[model samples]
Target chain A: DARVTQTPRHKVTEMGQEVTMRCQPILGHNTVFWYRQTMMQGLELLAYFRNRAPLDDSGMPKDRFSAEMPDATLATLKIQPSEPRDSAVYFCASGLTADGKGAADTQYFGPGTRLTVL
Target chain B: DQQVKQNSPSLSVQEGRISILNCDYTNSMFDYFLWYKKYPAEGPTFLISISSIKDKNEDGRFTVFLNKSAKHLSLHIVPSQPGDSAVYFCASGYKAAGNKLTFGGGTRVLVKP
Candidate 1:
């Protein structure tokens, strides 16, 4: 019955505002991923962390976006000076491990945070 | 430069029929492939997966077929029910490349009952 949980399921903000999305991964999962979904681009990997350490973030924009996993249970993605193009659904997923060693072998997703920047 | 592609934007099928969703990939190194189903306002949920070494894997009514030579894979749902209506996304990843999945734009399936 364990599942990933995300807060601020819906967010509406003006352009140039700052937006922060939070995720609580499933207990005992060692890998976490952040993705952005848009009609044009589909699901794009923003960043990912294994054992609370970021392993890849090349998919993310360097100027105003950042992702962090401060602890085992929490992962956060922030967008400073958000623009209209940043409006999309942000998803958080967790797996048991980075590689297949301890992983359940599949990523479980949260309800996702829908962000609308005007 | 989309690594994965689901060409069909949407499909409509009658209930009790078979639903076939197709996906093609450009990355030859993609060793893992997955299919996910998404409803409006909800996150995409993992439906099934197949490794590059295998050509087919099935769970209940769902089956995934991979053709490495063609770099194509497919998901087939038999006796499709009304509940099977959702957006289906195709994703591929290379385990050696950090396991970050590259997703397609998704195909919306409407099973009319």
Candidate 2:
């Protein structure tokens, strides 16, 4: 079964430290998305890429967060000078790049990286 | 502002009973809706989806009903089982745009045997 995979299932870092989370999307999927989940905000999309190109990063904090897809399979999200407020589960999802399927097309998600910034 | 809303924070159902979860949206631009289920320490997984053109779609025990006029959608799980317990999230998306899902606060469901 093809599954989206994320590395470092858990992380604990000091405030002001840099944190990087990595993801390996399912093979053949061309679209990638990064999301943050917290008790207060629920699920928020930070950024996404299509065909290894950044499509939108409007929801992300520009000063502290960055998302990139180095290649089709590897996608990364990084936070510099991470603050305690950045603590949340970061999820990566993959989907088809084409939209001809309409609403039927769906995204497959990874297990997620749980980051705790102190 | 939250475009999608799941008012109930949690729902409880007994085995062999039907559990219905509802979601409402404010944006008419949202032409598609999806349901996702999540367990602790894991990301949300796609459960089911329905388009604005269709009123209902079903897969096994799970069924989704959409009412475009009311801007509402619901998920029905018949014969709820212990394994069915989890947090369910409702998401909406605009068909013209790429699949960037706008999700609602999830509802935690508990199934008792």
Candidate 3:
């Protein structure tokens, strides 16, 4: 069975440290999404890429957070000088779209990376 | 402003009973809705989905009902099992947008055996 895989299932870093989370989307999936889950905010989309191209990152903090799909197989989210408020579970999800399947498509998520910034 | 809202933060139900989770949305652009279930320490998984054109969709023990006029949707799980304890999230999105969803605050359900 195909699944999305995320590295660093757990991370504890001091504030102001740079944290990088990696995700390997299921092979053959064309779209990748990055989401953050927090107690106060619930689950929110940070950014997403379609076919290795950045589609939208409006929900992400451009000053400190950056999401990129260096290639089709690898998608990365990096936070420079990460702060305490950045502590949350970061989830990477992949889905098959681009064929106009739009709303009918379902996203397959990876075991999220739990980030704890002190 | 949260376009999608799950008013109930938690629900408790006995095993073999019916569990209902409701979600309401304020976005008129959303023509499609979906439900996702998340277990502790795990990512949310797709549960069920319904389009504005359809009033209801059913799969196995899970049923999703959509009310476009009321801008509401609900998920029904019959004969709930202990394993059904998890967080359920309701999401809405536009058909024109490809797979990007606006999610509501999840409801934590506890199924007592």
Candidate 4:
């Protein structure tokens, strides 16, 4: 059974500290997405990449948050000077997309990293 | 604005009974809808999905009904079991977009034996 693997299942950091969450998508999947889930906001997409190239990062906070797929296997979401408001569960999802079409998008999600910023 | 809405925060059902979870959307552009089930500390898993072109889709004990005109959709689980107790989320995607799913606030389903 293939699954998306996420590192550091739980994290606790002081405010203004740097936090980095990593994900290893399924081997053959080509698309990866980063999402944040909180009690207030539910689930919100922060960014996504296709073929290691970022397709959109509009939902991400430009000043403090960054998401990147350095290679096919590794994807990371980093926050500098993280705030308490950034405390949420971050999930990474992978999907197989041969074409650019939306019809082929079927995402398989990771277990998620729970972050608590004090 | 909440594009997708699940009005009920939770639902309770008896074992061997039917559980119906409803979702409504305000966006007329949404063409594809999906249902996901999530347990505590676990990621949401895909359950059932329906396209705007179809009214109903069924798989095993699960079924999804879509009402395009009303912009509503529902998930039905027959013979609800203890294992089926989880949070269910409704998501919708636009056909021309990148399939970035906009999700609704989930409804927690409790099954009692």
* Candidate achieving the largest lDDT: 3
- Native-referenced DockQ of model 2: 0.58
Where does candidate 2 chain B have its weakest 10-residue lDDT segment?
A: B92-101
TM, every model: 0.96, 0.97, 0.97, 0.96
Model 1 residue B92 lDDT? 86
Per-residue lDDT for B1-113 in model 3, tens only?
A: 99999999999999999999999999898988899999999999999998888999999999999998899999999989999999999998886778898899999999999
Question: Where in model 1 is the C-alpha error above 4 Å?
Answer: A98-104
- Angstrom error of the Cα, residue B18, model 3: value is 0.4
Which candidate number has the best DockQ? 3
lDDT of 4 by residue, A1-118 (tens): 9999998899999999999999999998888999999997888989978888898898899999999998999999999989999999999999876575555356788999999999
Of the candidates numbered 1 and 3, which has the greater lDDT value? 3
Candidate 1 local lDDT, B55-94, one digit each (tens): 9999999999999999999999998999999999998887
iRMS, all models = 2.7, 2.4, 1.8, 1.7
Candidate 1 vs 4: which has more DockQ: 4
Model 3 — TM-score against the truth? Answer: 0.97
How high is the DockQ of candidate 4?
0.61
The digit string of per-residue lDDT tens for model 2 on B1-113 reads: 99999999999999999999999999999887899999998889999998888999999999999999899999999989999999999999876667778999999999999
- Cα lDDT of model 1 by residue, A1-118, tens digit: 9999999999999999999999999999888999999988889999988888898899999899999999999999999989999999999999865554433257899999999999
- lDDT against the true structure, per candidate, is 0.92, 0.91, 0.93, 0.91
